[model samples]
Target: MLWIPIDRSLDIPLIRQVYQQIRERILNGDLQSEEKLPSTRELAFELKVSRNVILEAYDQLIAEGFLVTRRGSGTFVAKGTFLEKRVVPNHALNWRENKTDAANIIDFRSGLPALDLFPRKTWAKLSHAIWNDTSHSMFGYDLPEGRPELRQALARYLLKTRGVACHPEQIVITSGATQALTLVSRLLLSPNDTVIMEDPITNDIQTIFKTTGATIFPIPVDEYGIKTALLPENKKPKLIFITPSHQFPLGGTLPIQRRIQLIQYSRKTNCYLVEDDYDSEFRYEGPPVSSLQGLEPECVLYVGSFSKILSPALRIGYLVLPLQLIEESRRLKWFSDLHTPSVEQLILARFIDEGYLERHITRMKKVYKKRRDYLMHCIKTTFSNEVQVFGYSTGLHLIVEVTNFHFSKEKLKQIEQCGVKVYQVEEHTIEKDKHQNQLILGYGHLNQEEIKEGIARLHVALYK
Candidate 1:
């Protein structure tokens, strides 16, 4: 039996202080279930406090249903209550990747930036300027939607960079695109609503849809991205989400022809299409792909993030909604964490105003272009005529198809034991046997030296 002591020297009431500690210990599993707690008299004696304080604390916990009195059973721990365990995170492994494990050997996980190459000097200056010059509003809950300057800056930047025609009034800031998805899911979806997502999309999207209770329907994607023809006609969806600019994992551009068709699909079905222009700013080849949002401003919800282009730590993301939904979206944003942090929003607004973001993104595009080409070259030279890779012309990743090899969880475990890590395309699928023979390789964050070394190690892993 363990008892917590409350110090009498503290200004905080002994009952409150004692209650908080015991509550946290139980919730965090430090106090095991069915473990008998100390009697109120014993706890008061050890702490040198009035027995009333200990009694009060225990009574509060019991009132809150965190503890239960079992009559003669001596207050046994409550069984099958909500507080004990929550949020079981997934740890599934995909075998088609077969890249070298990160702990032992380098791995090419997608959507990561070569953070070592980020511009720290410029950011330090911006951070200093924002703190020194910003008003008191910068310290408080600014606006749930976003800071006026940051929203306007992002509005202008999106137009200039990605051809997204948006106004500050229509842009609602989010913590990141993931949080954007979380809030958007709640804002847009009702129970049992259908959601259209890319086949073999990021696994996190699958988790998001599941959590939201949205019945996700996989839309087939090709080299040019989501096939508008493959969209389900019988099951009308509430929302359709896609990475049209640079398709995730597969790297297709969802060309203008398909973009127009997708918008038409949304119009016909009376649904909204959520376009995630996640990494379009970092395209290595051709002119930047035109965003689907630019096609039909009224029907498409545009989402953009700084994680890939600027830095993930910034955690700044924005959603451009059509004016019709702006009021509804704003009301929801007011309740969800109020708003994003003001310091970053202020600093970033200044950074965009000063053209620092433009210059940095321009420089990074060229650097990433070199790295992407080098990877393609190595694969072409090494594989010779053996493997076929798709969507390497843009974005942070490309898929390599293996017709000869079979990917299984047991094989993934074998590769893991060998100290290699890779993501199989199948890991992202809701429908099985889709993308079973494909591997999504991420080289966006790796430099030339790291890329060559990692690919070489991957070859050795599979062959050996």
Candidate 2:
């Protein structure tokens, strides 16, 4: 007699359980070819399940060619039904065991906004209104270029704020700046193509471009941004990636002279400049810096996202591409995920149109400014002349260069064990050892108390 186990405690249907067990046995070669199965009535009687359950299971197996029956004979396992099972390594178990808990540590990582300050009430109100009045067509797939409503609103806002000049037709909505860079790499790069980028850029950006199999020509940046004079004259790169308004990790605004040089170089070489204008709106100094895109819209592919200004969770960013690349970009975007979520786009469109986004940024600017000031004050009091702060005029994070000190891997681990976490500037540098003493400390998400305690702990970790 062929026996199959049944348990009443399981939520699965009796027919499914029976079907799965028999299929597993057949696939594992436990039941050989042409092996006879017990009659449905006998199996149902033995397993204490309904006859109909056994009949359904057998019928399904027969339909799937796992079982066959003769005119007057009972069911038999089909030939060639067995398959060898392969073992998959449990990599996630090791990763989970080694993961660090963030709750206990005062983390000062960059690019994180204050989640508590997000305009939740306004967003909820707009979301409710949008869903209530949404058109039937919105339930279907949207254009790959994104909703024109949001694009139009962004075009106007970018023009007024960042001096970016473009119509909604040039804008292609993306999941975030990461996706924008990925798409740009796909559009402009081929294997072994040359590209130029800052030496100490965000590691994620470096990884994105490297995945395209392009050769990255690293240009060193200073207090003013990328050294445009260092750009290779003989090399004709396909793309030049930059963070002009505020350089990542180092936080230097590219000067107008360098900006013009970049434009001239791109035009001469017929290459595209990808301008990432991230977190330029929160400049604490004079007026927000005008984008490199506005200088030469034809040569620049402008990338902007709400990830830094508002919240990263929104996953809404856009690329203001040159007119020539717009169609191909739309096609590539369609091939990638088939468009960003439509409902959020509609809600954000309303949010921007009603001046809520501006108001929120205005409010957060003051809050972030205060936090930035407090963090600076705490660092000054704790470290005194031992550290010099750089790039505090704009953006959410600033660089602190520790005098005559290098943040080695062991030192960083020691700092983390002391209940504080900080990022090393060397982590973002392509040619390391130059920025070994500098640390990128972000203050946008931290409160004054946490900032004070974190600095105090860091001081002890460094000096002790």
**Separate clash counts for every candidate:** 5, 0
lDDT over C-alpha atoms for residue 348 of model 2: 92
- Cα lDDT tens digits, model 2, 280-399, are 999998879999999899989999999988899999999999999999999999999899999999999999999999998889889889999999999898888999998888889999
Candidate 1 residue pairs that clash: 100-420, 100-421, 101-419, 101-420, 101-421
What tens-digit string does per-residue lDDT give for candidate 1 at 104-185? 7566688888799888999899899878887876687678899999999988888987889888999999999988887678
* TM-score of every prediction relative to native: 0.78, 0.92
In order, what lDDT does every prediction score?
Answer: 0.81, 0.92
After superposing candidate 2 on the true structure, give the runs of residues whose Cα lies further than 4 Å from its correct spot: 10-16, 87-96
